[model samples]
Target: MQPPLIERNVADVCRTVLDDATEDVLAVGPSPTVVDGLVAMLADRENGPSVRLLATESVLKASVSEFTDASVIADLVADESLSLRTSAERLDGPLLVTDERVVSLVTTDERTAGLATDDAAFVDAAREEYTDRWADAESFRLRTPPLSRVQESLEREFDEELAADFERMRIALAEADGHLDEVDISLLAAARNEALLYDISTWGEGVGIASRATFSRKKTRLEEGGLIETEKVPIDVGRPRLRLLLGDDHLRGIDADEVVSVAAELLAAARQ
Candidate 1:
């Protein structure tokens, strides 16, 4: 007999399987929505099943492309709320197998659904196959560092005043930042104090946020957009370090929390 197929909105497809699960959950090659969905679900509930998510590089890339969401993933992993891994091998799935049942996903433009079954043979086979695959997978790491780590680094390495400024921007930008990334925000924060690009970029790299090249490229882009200004600072080293500053009269001397909003506004106006 054919297993019952329950259709749902794409976001809800994973919830059904996750909610009904009594023990561990294993997912292989999940979709971006599924990955985000599981992450989001874990955010609201105190706890759910112990989830083991294994993804392909392509899907994992798509999932953590958003920095905010990726930050949460990092926190979840750090706390052991979610066990995430990725495989280099060819495994295509949005397949989910739980202690009580097995679920196979069906995705479409409008909705995603799951065909769930409790059959012993099907569930056991899926569980075994995916368990083996999970064993073969490696821990998935994202470029976005956990929020806690960022805070700790800022507070410990820099003074409280600077760290507070950074936290203010982070909180302000959490909801929306005109599409600015962590690099953009960090550069802006650094420019607020006319801090050196070398210092800021080095800090970012040490924090697992990004690389020096990435910061340099973003600084160039921001400079070209007239969002920030840089002046060469004399250093007793290989090259003169560049100091970051806000280029716009409107952005200069504004509150730390307001920088992202002003920058975003500037970007939107320029787009017009």
Candidate 2:
């Protein structure tokens, strides 16, 4: 069955507000679309507005690509600064991120991003409540990306076959520490059948781990799923040497429920 049509009028409002605001505009929220739209809106010199944004650290980091030179608006007490705010109840839709006074509000709704709201009649009243808290709020600077760095990060790493596995590994282990760089998991998979212990030095010597033919074949298998990617890191002398992750057949012995339980435990701990 098809779901009911829910109109997203907030996007239009956001577009209108960005299109109209002349001076500095403040906004806050976790919506990437809002950041993207606002950044694009402000990037224009002729028709664009001056947009300032506030958001949670996670959202800010994830949407780093969308911002211009954003500084942390620490003066939450000041009417002109932007800061993050969340609602008591976790609502289904996006909330308004801006007030007429000075700061912006960030909410869960995707549509309400850069838009002005009819609900902002008490902007002054809300500012009073915010001042009490902003004085105690700690500030951190927003990270800006260099254009050169952005372009460098977008290039492909390994060939298609191994690329997909590396990409999936990165996604699955995104929160895992020490997993930042791209890896060719197929190389590890190739080492799986061999008894040869390949060290980083040996790998540098051009004789280590999986045979080139074997690794190449494994890459082919991974490519069948889809092209995956990760940043390639040269495994220099490491605590643990690189090897291809053993494929699905190795996981056949474990019950699926065990995996689910382990994942649930990790998630629960993460929330805490």
Q: What does candidate 1's lDDT look like per residue over 1-272, in tens digits?
A: 23555555644766777888888889878878778777877666677777889998788888777767788888777777788888988876788889878777888777776877788887888899999999888887777788778878877776677678787887777778446878888888888867899988998999998999999999998888889998999978688889998899999778888888888888777667
What is the alpha-carbon lDDT for the whole of candidate 1?
A: 0.81
Question: What tens digits encode model 2's per-residue C-alpha lDDT throughout 1-272?
Answer: 11222224334445555444445444544366655444444343344433444355555565542222221122221223233433332222233323453323233453232222334556555444444333444443444323222222222322333333333433443334331112233233122322122331233123222345544453444433222211233455654533433343433243322322233333344346
- Model 1 pairs whose backbones collide: none
Candidate 1, superposed: residue stretches over 4 Å from native = 1-13, 87-92, 107-112, 138-141, 155-179, 193-199, 230-243, 252-272
Q: Which stretches of candidate 2 lie over 4 Å from their true place?
A: 1-12, 44-49, 65-121, 127-144, 148-272
Model 1 TM-score, 2 decimals: 0.73
What's model 2's overall lDDT? 0.36
Question: What C-alpha lDDT values do all the predictions have?
Answer: 0.81, 0.36
Deviation (Å) of 192 in candidate 2: 35
lDDT for residue 151 in candidate 2, whole number 0-100? 23
Best by lDDT: 1
